[model samples]
Target: MSDDVVAPVATAAPATHEPPARDITDGGPDMVQFLDADGQPVALNEVNSPYAEYVDAIDDEQLRSLYRDLVLVRRVDAEGHALQRQGELGLWPSLLGQEAAQVGAGRAMRPQDYAFPGYREHGVAWCKGVDPINLLGMFRGVNHGGWDSNENNFHLYTIVIGNQMLHASGYAMGVQKDGMVGTGDPERDTAVMAFTGDGGTAQGDYNESLVFASVAHSPVVFFVQNNHWAISEPNDRQFTIPPYQRARGFGIPGVRVDGNDVLASLAVTQGALDRARSGGGPTLIEAFTYRMGAHTTSDDPTKYRIAAEVDIWKKKDPIDRLRKHLESKGLADQEWLEALDAEADELALRIRTACQQMPNPPHSEMFEKVYAEPHPLVEREREEFLAYQASFEEED
Candidate 1:
C-alpha cells in the first residue's frame, strides 16, 4: 500500500480575510465560543457569527450521530487506558476530553480531504472510518500503525509530536503542484488537515511547516488542539500568545474556537476547509480545550496539576454539552441516550477483544518491509533472523 498525507464569528458578515475578535495580549484565554459551560447557547460575535449558519446546517439526526460518535470515541479512549493499565498494551495516549474538537473537525471534512494526525487523534481516525482495532496494533507492539493510510486518506499517527506538520505541508504542496487546488469542482479538489498538540507548537518543525505553507499558499488547515497542558508544562511556558495567533505572524489567518463546543468546532473547521479548497491558502485553528487525563499511560497529572483543575474542565465536557443540547432541543430522550450507552459498551468490548487478539509480527518482518526494493544488507539480516529462529527450533 502507498503512504499518503493530509473559524470564527464577527458582526455584519465580515469578509473571509477578517480576523476574529480575540485578545491574546494579556495572556488570557479568549476564544470564539458558541456554547458555554452549562451547555447553553451563547451569541456569536461578528467574526464568529458567520459560522452559526454552518452549525445550523446540522440536522437533528446528525446531532444525534455526533453525540453517539462522541460517546463511542470516549469509550474507545477509556478502554485503551484500561488495557494499558492491565498490561495489554505497552502504552496509550488517551484522547480523553478532546472529543468535540476532534469529532467536530473530522465530521466537517469531505471524503476527498486528507488528514494528518498526531498520536492522540483517535476520534479523528474513528471519523475517517479507521477501525478502532487498527489503532491498537501500535500500542500493542504489533506494528507502527495497523491501517493502510492510502485507503482512507488518513495518515498513520505521528508520535513525534511536530513531525507530521512537515509531512502535511509537503503533501499540500504536492496537491497544489498537481493542479488539485482551486478547482471549481468540489469533488475533484482536495485540502489537507494537519493536527498537532499545543506542545507541538513549540517545535521547530511546526514553525517551519507554517513558514512553508504560508509562502507556498498551500491548501492546508493547521489544526492545533490546545488542550491546556503540554505534559504538565502549561501553555504559558510555550508561548506568549495562543497557538492560533502565531498563524497571523506567518500571514496565515487564524482563529481560536471553544474546543469543547462541538458545533463551533465543526463550523469553524468547515469554513477553513472551504477556504482552502477554494485557493484561500492555509488557516490555523486553535481548539482551546483541556486534557482530562495524563499525556499518556506513563504520565501522572496529580504530580503537577490539581484534581480541582480537572474537575473544572469536566463541567465543560464536549459529549455532555452536545447531549444536553440534544435533550433540551428534544432531539434525544432518555431511552435513546440509554441505547447509545449500550452501544458504547459493545464497542468497548470489541476494542478490548480485538486489542488482545492482535498478533505479534514475525521477527523477519523487521527487514522485509524496510524498503520497496530489496537490498543485500536487508536480505542478509532477514536470513540471519530466520537462521536464528531455526537454531532455537533445532534445540527444542
Candidate 2:
C-alpha cells in the first residue's frame, strides 16, 4: 500500500556517507563457497568474506538436519515429477539439485518473514507449511494456486518471468511504511525473500526490484537460485559475468554460495536475513547450484544440454553430498538415514494417493478467484456455468 517509488543507489554496501565501490569481486562461479563438492571440510580461516562466522558454526545435528531436509525436499520434488509423468498434472518443474538452496533459505526465514517465490519454489512452500497435495493442484491444472498465500505468509506462485520481484518490492515497501523495518523486534521486523532463477536476471523487473529495494533500504533478500540452465538457455547466454555480481551494479551487498551444499546455503541465507532484519537493506544471494533434471516434465534436457554435464552434476548430487558430509561427521547413522529413506518412500505413496483423488472442478475455475468483488460479466458467466453443470446428472 505505500505507493512510493524509489531511485537507484550505486553503492556496494550500506554506509554513513556513501558505499565504497559499485563492483564486487567475481570468483568465476567459485566465490563464496564454504563447502566443497566432495563434501569435505575444505574452507577455513577466511577473512575476505563476512560469512565465515556462520560457516564455522555448523554442528553435527545441524548437518543431519540438512541431510533430512534434502531427503524430504527431494521426495516432494519427485512426487511432483511423478504427477506430471502420470498425466495427473499438466507441467512439473523439477528442483533436483537445488534442494539445499531452497530448504536452507526457506528455513532461514522467521515465521514473521514474508516470501515471494517463483513458480518452481515448491520447496520453499513446503517450508512455509503448504501441503504437498496443494502444490500439485496448480500443475494439475485444477487451480491457479494451491493455498491462500496470506495464510502462510507466501505469495502466489509467480509464472511470469521476474514479475514477483516487483510484487516483492512493493510488499517490502509496505512493511517499511507500516514501520515494520528496523523495529528492533525480530518478529516486528519483516523481511522478504524473493526467489528467482538465473534466467530471470535478464528481466527488467528483477533489476528494478533491486533498484527500489536498495534505495528504500527495504528488508528484502533477492534469492537467485542459479541452476545454471534457464530452461534451454544457459547462464552464459544471460550475462557475461555471474549473476551475484549483477547485484553490485544495483549498489547492494551480494554473495554467491555453493548452492547444492546445505551448510553453505543455510549460512549465507541466515546471514543475509539477519542483515536485512537489522536494517542493512537488501542483499542478493546467488545460490550457485545445478538443475539436475529437465526444466519441467514437458521439455527433455537431452535435446539441448549434453549428457556429460548431467553426469558431472550427478556426481555432485545435493542429497548424496550432504549425506556424505553428515556421515563423515559421525552424525549419520545407518538406521537413521535408512529410516529417513523409508519415510521418503511413504511420503511418495501418500502423495501418489492424493494425486488419484484430485477432484475435477467445474468450469467456474475460469474465474472463481480472479476478483474479490463480483463483476457483472463474471457473475453472468459463473451463473451460466452453474446452469450447465445442473444440466448433468447429480446425486441430489
The candidate that wins on TM-score is 1
Total residue pair clashes for candidate 2: 0
For residues 7-58, write the lDDT of model 1, one tens digit per residue: 2221111122123233211112346677776678887677568788897888
Give the candidate number with the greatest lDDT: 1
- lDDT of each residue in 1-396, candidate 2, tens digit only: 011222221111122212223322122433456556677865463421566677667667777776777788799898889778878888899998889889888888888899999988978887888888888888887776778899989898999999999999999888888888777987688889999998999999998999999899998999998887788887556776566666777888777777777777888898888888888889999887788899989889877766665666677777887777777777888899889999999888988898788888867778776788878988898898888788775746
Clashes in model 1: which pairs?
8-47, 8-48, 9-46, 9-47, 9-48, 9-49, 10-46, 10-47, 10-48, 11-46
lDDT of each: 0.84, 0.79
Model 1: residues >4 Å from true position, as ranges? 1-30
